[model samples]
Target: MPVVPPPVFALAAGIAQHLLAPDRPAGGARKLASAGIAVAALGLDASAVAAFRRHHTTVNPLDPARASSMVTGGAYRLTRNPMYVGMAGLLTAHAVRRGGWLTPLPAAAFVVLVDRLQIPAEEAAMEANFGEAYARYRARVSRWLPVRA
Candidate 1:
């Protein structure tokens, strides 16, 4: 079977969130905050994509071995998987706007699935290609969120 894309999982999670929460129309401030979060998350994803393009590397998640260079700058400096972070952020924004207790479940599930099933292989490929540089990057930066003391 062909591998399903991460964006597809993100989309399904969004749909599931909506079904669970049933988004209510937000007031002015809430609407603005949600939009802001979504735009920032999109920008994070865009910066990661731009970094890949700048390095002349492939952004294809399915084929991590094809990555020509390591991307440790831009949004990558924040999280090794900015695209996944952006998707989770978007889902979080949606959950905030929707305001149902169960709304966040799908987003949480999406993160867990990606972390468990997707990241290990990608990390292996990165280590195989970039070796110690990738190891250092992984050690310094986080797999998902950047948590600092």
Candidate 2:
């Protein structure tokens, strides 16, 4: 089963298509190059998470339907929300690569939708199921960024 809703996936696919589409650079070469690098990095990170997921079977976000074991290996060691962070990174990179005054709107919309809708529901379910374990993990791992401390 897919993790994200079909509409969310559609929006993500559209943004990705826009990012990959060829166009004359309205923005400078430097900005375009930076965004391309960012997108590449995001893709690499996402691949890493996918590899980890394939290797381990204990990283489900849906608590009621989660695996019995907690995953602490691979990308989970760096952050609790690696998959979501990867998705956000991809969206940000897509926005930056697009390059316009309104370039960030789609990324902002993604953040709002995930934060306001998906994450809250997931967190509540996690909290109910995992209790202190989830809390401790949250305290350690940054929500959509790597933990600095």
Scanning candidate 1 in windows of ten residues, the lowest lDDT window is: 1-10
lDDT for every model? 0.87, 0.62
Measured against the true structure, the TM-scores of the candidates, in listed sequence, are 0.93, 0.66
Q: What is the lDDT for 4 in model 1?
A: 66
Give the per-residue lDDT of model 1 (tens digit) for 50-118: 888999999887888898999898888889999999999899899878777998999999898888877
Which portions of model 2 miss their true places by more than 4 Å?
1-23, 26-48, 51-64, 147-149
What value does the lDDT take at residue 101 in candidate 2?
A: 50
Question: Which ten-residue region of model 2 has the weakest summed lDDT?
Answer: 60-69
Off by over 4 Å in 1: none
Model 2, span 1-149: residue lDDT tens? 23675246536744654765457554676477657757765775666557656756444444324644455556676766566666666666665656555656666676676667667776776677778998888788766666476
Q: How well does candidate 1 match the true structure, expressed as C-alpha RMSD?
A: 1.7
Whole-model lDDT, model 2: 0.62
In the order shown, what is each candidate's alpha-carbon RMSD?
1.7, 4.5
